[model samples]
Target: MDPRQEEQINAQVIAVFPDKVRIIVDDLEDFKIAEESLKVGSYVKIADNENAVLIAIIENFQIAVSAEGKRDHIIEAFPLGILRNGKFERGGDSLAIPPKEVQPATISDIKKIYEDSVPKEASFRFATLSSNISVPVPVNGDKFFNKHIAVVGSTGSGKSHTLATIIQKAVSEKGDGFSLNNSHVIIFDIHSEYKSAFPSANHIDISNLALPYWMLNSEELEEFFLDTEANDHNQRNIFKEAIIKDRLAKFSGSASEKQNIHLDTPILFDIREVLAYAIAKNEEMVNTGEVYASSNKEKAGQPKYTQGSLHGKLTNFVNRLENKLNDSRLNFFLGEQSMKITFEETLQKLLGYSSKSESNVTVIDLSGVPFEVLSITVSLISRLVFEYGYIYKRIRCAKNPNEKINNDIPILLVYEEAHKYVPNSDLSKYRASKVAIERIAKEGRKYGVTLLLASQRPSEISETIFSQCSNFIAMRLTNPADQGYVKKLLPDSLGSLIDKMTSFRQGEALLVGESIILPSIVQIEPCIHTPSSSDIPYWQLWKEEWKNMDFAAIKEEWYK
Candidate 1:
């Protein structure tokens, strides 16, 4: 290189540490150039020696007057990884290089560094760097997704678009011949927005998404069917006994099998029959002209029948149960007419691989579902998927001990508006879904089940769940609380990047963690089929002439 070019690139390393470097900018012209080029979160390379290059990020900068009253501009950077020879090694060793050895990395230098650092296998080109030169950022798909991931941003910050892009890219076969035939992704579509994104995806709304009523465990049943706070102890016991008796009779088999039927058993049983038994027990009378206590084990000392102490107490409970049974909105659970369909069939419908003609992505739209039973519904579906995946992996592992575990068909479960279900607050009302999802977040990876959690409020999400995530795609989060939550989740080395979240564009995100070689700002590629979450054009709609309103039809639909 020429003397002038070398001098232009060279900068003085004022101070150095294991993970960070402090550079001093003295030349006015060079400082101006550095100010323009070395942006926060931008990559830089420092020459440790002729054979080794230390890569770092410009985290912060300061302008101050030195002891001699001379102006000084200092750039603080955190070392990402060291590139030695042609290979990339994580972390940097203590270097004794004198001042003026550090060089401001050029675009070509960065390209070479990224090309050598990013692995070829198990990686995909997803986004490009928003820099002077357009450089494709190849991410390790396996590493990014194998561990849990969180995609969080405020409203209108491209959270939905970023998620859609990821799904589209995963299922897209146009480039790299990536086949999603074996990929099983179930999206819990909260607002019915993603139905059109993947035309080949299996779209399941409340109309066709039937969750067998018997799938609810005891806690879920209590949460949905009986109001524990309102119901007395005897009423709850009577309800539990009826459920056990009905489930045992429905799944009658060998003596050993009958022993397995408990209150929480996931067996197909008529909910109406259980309700009838409970009512009958509530109405049953004994010889003492009193209510019969079916749950009372001490027969000798018990009042034979005192008009069934639970008769009046259970009226509200029975009324609630009846209301739920009759609710058309809850037909997904109560309207299962196909008695021939077994649990295996339901599992296949929920988790089966979609062929080329079929849709691989199954979106469970919860928009039409009633709010009261929404949590239990989500719990049932999430629990079923987790249990099925857990059992499948165990059986597969037992059958072929020598086979690789990754060979199993992986399922990616996407939870939209996750904060509604998995809140960090201990007093959250939705415990059923929270517990189910937390179990998956903690243990799903071993069984080939991954989670993609998208939320508008990171501060509201469960800390345990958020902490497990290995990759983060954070967009423009203006809220200070949200930004602080994200900052706490990130490592100290990359915490400065969180400050830039407020300025990110719609589709731009800070990609960090196990996915990329280093934390970077990426312009995510546009999804081919956008979701139905676009903002409403209020101005345009207001300017247009109003059409004739259908008052009668609107009223009738509202009543329905």
Candidate 2:
């Protein structure tokens, strides 16, 4: 290098920290060397006498410096880092020799090194001294928020609690302006834990809530009647006809069919009407004749008529249907014969419009639904929401796909205790929760529907569904099968973080995947809105006694 060029260079070693070093230099105009591509976390080679050589550069740098003495002399303060392998002189001034060479590290190789060196506590985000390269940083974008997410933990691992924290952070984090206000989420809350978790959403609980069974397609209806056995084609048709009649009868008196009602419309069907039709169609006629000539008197045999013969036999079935229809406790399509309330009133109340805003996050409470029907009810409601969105888009964006901005309201469905519904397999091939969940996993993304599945047993969840998740929030897992299942889905880079799952705190979780550049084990923020269905303190309740003890006096007064 030329002497004039060296004179033009202004180099100053800023402060040297215990572990790292910082330096500043003028523009490359002076060094005249081609190795001026130094950056934070990059390696730069400095050589003296060809053999006395060392390398370091820029861990971090500021555009301006603010030290007291000689602060004006330094135009910039750049930190330099040297690994334990290289040594820097304590009081070395500027070296006359220039830097040798500099190059950018391969991101792939760095990622590999990162996976191997990351600490167990690190989630998808990590910074380590094992390599000179920086781990990938998770920026808020399509890569992170738009990707699918899954949370797996045991029953009490606080899955719902963790999810609430993550969503809260996503909207409030620095540098990210993404908010949940514009998002439309439809949660299939089997346990109804999230009713109060988010206050903004419209909550629809299907307890004794009636859904028109006729609204179900033939496939759905078939699944509904899986337990009933019908042999001949006639028998099957009889059942089908009975179902149709009951449906029509249930909706008959109120209003005319606005649309050409077909086998497809998802309106409420009358279970009472259908069962009545079934009984009526299956009834058998009986004929009785008195034997008159049997005892040598030889009275002629003639047909005998009984007044309540048919009525007597049909009594039990009618009673059953009437009892079901009359059960005022049940929210049935037809009001129980015993209850004076009409079906029309119940239907109106159920389908009545709620000012549910798509922008506001809504949590529907499902705790009131009966255990026997919980799985199917959850499936039906979720399917209905997605189906509604699918239809809404087709009409709004008729000709062009790009003109779908008006139709794009992304929704996230958080399934708590997802394993109960979406188990591994269905040997009988009925209305399996696994199938419904798999459909959402594969197709929900296109319809602007996303699922956030929370479960303790990953091994019990469908492999295909679990594999589709792009981001994962993992807490403690003692089950080896679950651990092994998660291991398969986890990136090799997150091996260490997976090991920490067993020791994670109640609300703490290892967050890994696209949303985070490196895996990070974070303490989730506590939720402000409390869930309604937590365990109660029975022991404490028993400690309290009744306020009044006038039992003997009350009895004496009554006797007097």
Candidate 3:
């Protein structure tokens, strides 16, 4: 090799470590190609004499003043992966002792790492490289959606926008011909922000939502109606007994199944009938058989009566049950409409499968759901998706046992602002949702149900659910707890890169996990239609002309 060629290289490898490699830059302005100068977050390739090349991202730069008053530039970079035989494989530190050549990664080099590694048909693009906006980043679509995804950030940090962009690209991207694709997405829009984004979606609010109350499992039933604060054992036993009996007596199914009924069975059982049964049990008299004499036939036998064992025990339970039945706010799940609707019909509305409504996205606006029963609603929906997957898989395998690829119409459930219901606390109010969602996080993928959880307060989310996420889009987070919580991805070789979370601009995020070819800091592309998540321009609105108040209208709407 000529010495002049070595001098023209501009960058030289000085050192290599397990997690990072050191490089010394002879001249920063020597490279007039690659579209950019070397800086933090830039990708570079280091090669040794043995043909082993390692890909690394620049972390920080330092300037050292020599004894001769000369200045030297040194770069510290975190090793991302190694390029072997024209393919990029994750896991670094395979380079030999002293690397011979170091240079900025060309556009082609960046593409080879992010795009060429994944088949063009399997690529899903939602963002571009933060260092080079022209380079679009692609992730393996199957790995991304099949596994759970977590997107967390501070308020106004573009979490909603990121979710919208991903889903929008998914639903609109067509394969062969222009017919409807095989994509199905159900978004639990807690703040009612997704309807505007998916205008054609099957948008169901509390007014149109008919989630049956009978479908709730025992835990959800107790969490829904029973006073958790009281913790009365009698209330629980009586409620369970009443529901089982009511179901057995009313079920028109085969007698054998009725005999095998249990408290957790997802069958139709009247809550009003359960309340009536509780009332009857509470008011029963113990003065029946022996206390009544044969003299009653002639003397109208006046037999003494005693209060039944459950006389006063169920008073509070029955009263609370009746109050909840009469509460208009709770009518969405408790009313006759919810009971009349079959599980298939409910799934039709929720999955956008009904003949009347055909769409790829179903946004269940949860803002109108009563806060007290929010957990119950989320639990019921999450369980429904999981069970659908489980049942669909069973039926498919029953027909064709050779290959058990279940759930042809796979679904992804998006929980926007997930912490409101599935919080980390052991409080009984959050138990229902936490259990249902955690089950999905653990085993939903096998049955074709995956989760896309987006929240601003990630530290408050249940670890059982949050830890199972295989993909993450961590945006700007200002809170220390959130920052520290997200920084645990350090094991992915993000050393000092994770420290930049505090300063990332809106729409920029640290993209990592099993989906992408390599972890990257990316700028989320502008979504086709953004969510209604922008902050209210208070100061801008205050400059408008004074307006009259309408208290009467507000009061009337509040009552409804």
**lDDT winner among the candidates?**
3
lDDT of 2 at 190: 65
Residues 218-327, candidate 1: write the lDDT tens digits. Answer: 87878777776664687688788888888788775898999888888877777788778777765766467454466766664555645655556567667777887787
- In order, candidate lDDTs are 0.76, 0.54, 0.87
What tens-digit string does per-residue lDDT give for candidate 3 at 478-558?
A: 999988877864354677777888888999999988988888899999998879965789998999999899999999889
TM-scores for all candidates: the values are 0.88, 0.59, 0.95
Give the Å error, residue 75, model 1: 4.0
Poorest 10 consecutive residues of model 2 by lDDT? Answer: 75-84
Q: Which stretches of candidate 1 lie over 4 Å from their true place?
A: 1-3, 6-10, 17-20, 26-42, 49-51, 59-78, 97-100, 173-180, 289-306, 338-340, 352-357
| Local lDDT at 137 for model 2 | 29
Clashes within 3 Å, all models in order: 8, 24, 0
Residues 1-560, candidate 2: write the lDDT tens digits: 34554342455445444333444554434423444344443443444444433334344455454565333322221222222233332212344334332222234433443354334333333222322324442323444445677888865667777676555444333334654335445566666677677665456664445554444566455545433242234434555666655556555544467334545555555665666665654464444555445453543564443453333444444555566455443353233331343334432232222333333455555666545445555665566656655776786678676784635656677777777667676632325455566777888777666788888888987777888898887888889999889988986634344777887667667767665534555555566665556767888977988566789999975553
Q: Residue 67 in candidate 1 has what lDDT?
A: 90
Clashing pairs in 1: 200-359, 290-305, 290-306, 290-307, 291-305, 291-306, 291-307, 291-308
Of the two candidates 2 and 3, the one with more favorable TM-score, higher being better, is 3
